[model samples]
Target: MEFNILNQSPVLNGHSVEQSLGHTTELAKLADRLGYKRYFVSEHHNMENVIGTSPEVLVTHLLNQTKNINVGAGGVMLSHHNPFHVAEQFQLISHLAPGRVNLGVGKAPGGTPLATAALQHELRSDIDSFNDRFLSLKSFVDGTHDNHKVLKISVDTESSKPDLFLLGGSLSSAKFAADNEVNYIFAHFIKNDENLLKEVASAYKELYPGGKFIAALSVLLTETEKEKKAAKEENSVYSLKFKDGRTLRVTTEKQVNDYIKNTDEKIEVEKSQLDMILGTKDEILSKLNELSNSCPIDEFMFHLPTADAALRNLTIETLAPIHTIHKEKAGIL
Candidate 1:
């Protein structure tokens, strides 16, 4: 198994942006020292709690801070920018840290309506142009755009190009990724549906035939007695089904409130036992072994979403993969 950390650079209560950013940097260094494979930052806009608006900038700073560790975006929303510009930025990053950058792209807005409008001001058709945007981005990276006339990604022949990945929680996205023949990361933390994951995995494998697939999920490794009890409370997973057959796990009350505040989608709620693995080291290991045996997941990416920064850092330290298999190349493949 391969292990990597996905950081949101979360600003917990009473912590300033500088402190949160500093803490995240320290954690990325710790990950490198502990043999964690990669460090990817999340992206959000107009989110006071989530300060990572520009993943490209974060990747560059982290690349300067760490050596021999891969740094990339958890994703840059594909609809937000021109494909050629996005390709050029990451290609330059590859020059800075050759063979150590991954470019994951998603279709999510990564922000509220106002923020999306502001960020995507010139590209007004982003909402309905995700597939087209990805195709163009891929063309630019693969040096097939304009019949090789312009905007070619100029990476060294010996070095790996910026890895391109499509990230999403929906099967529609999965099929698109497989059809396009790029890597894919399934966000189980967003939907928490194992059957859905397996369904997409099967389809993607059959369509792409030995392509890379990453399963990104959350982890909560607690030690204190109070922490154990509190972690269980966080596992009270609820599902809200919308009229358009869209369903997502509502992990926090704020998510529910935001849904109600933003849209008029009539929701039918369903409560179920949480399927995630979260506990002490032994219990979590057992669950991991079982998952590895039962599922065809290529690699597991862990994200700790706790507001308690100390505990979050501790979890990464304790779960550091001292024994996971290492690959010669940089990607999940």
Candidate 2:
């Protein structure tokens, strides 16, 4: 019943980017004090709502601010940067917070086509070579690369390597993580199919026993009907599947229309409910327990969907690990 956090640093309702980022920093410190396991920030680009464009910088700041709790990128989209640089960045951060840093990588572009193109303009590798890039990044992080031929990452050898996690929603991604002997996190908030979750978990476990399987879900801890309604209104997402087998998650219809207008590739748009868990603290805990029972989820990472800062803080406080532990000890959970 371990809990972690995935922050998007959304700039909601005309809030300034600095405000959003400041909130993220404070909440991360709160999560650390509450005994949460990890606080991972997402990487998104060219999105007005989300301002978390650089997760490595955020991870570094969070690591410096918090006394305990692992901090990292929920994922660094691998298609936009050089793998060697990515490995070197995280490896250096690991020295700052040894045994408390994570490096989760994903294949998604994490932005619109224009931003993706801009980011990758200088890189030699493309999205098609994501597998090879991920392997090379892993080798560099683990110090398994040939130092005689390739430049080493050159970090403190005594510092622990950042715990690697592969972030994806597909069974293929699950197999890929298992095959590589890395941890896997299913993006349940993006695509909440119960059967698919079970199948992916089973497949990963069958291939790599004892590997960590985490489910990242959208959650909203609501205290009133108005709050619940507002959260749901903001919770909806659209999954755009391109003809070339790429999928993009966008929040607004305007984004969908913009993508269609910008790209020449054909796409199929599917509006998703996002499967947000909206309820009181007790109800949310009950649903979480039920979900964990149904699947092989070793940990639950929450992606709070509300834009209201007050509601976000309340939700974090309500479900903090310390509160859960206290309730369990008192036999009231």
Best by TM-score: 2
- Model 1 stretches astray by more than 4 angstroms: 125-128, 153-160, 232-275, 323-333
Per-prediction TM-score to the true structure, in the order listed = 0.85, 0.94
RMSD of each: 4.2, 1.9
- Which pairs of residues clash in candidate 2, taking residues 3 or more apart in a chain or in different chains? none
lDDT of 2: 0.86
Tens-digit lDDT track for model 2 on 138-249? 8888777877245777636445788999999899989999999999999988877878988998899889988999989888788789977877777788999977577889
Candidate 2 at 92: error in angstroms?
0.5
lDDT of 1 at 148: 65
Q: For residues 1-333, write the lDDT of model 1, one tens digit per residue.
A: 778888988885567999889888999998998888788898887664688999999999999999978898889987677788888899889888988999999877676556766877776542456788889988888887776654355744236578888888887888899998998888887777888978877777778876788888778786577977786675676677767665555555676567556655577777765555677876766776676666677777887766688878778877777633442244442
lDDT of each: 0.78, 0.86
Candidate 1's TM-score: 0.85
Weakest ten-residue segment in model 1 by summed lDDT: 324-333
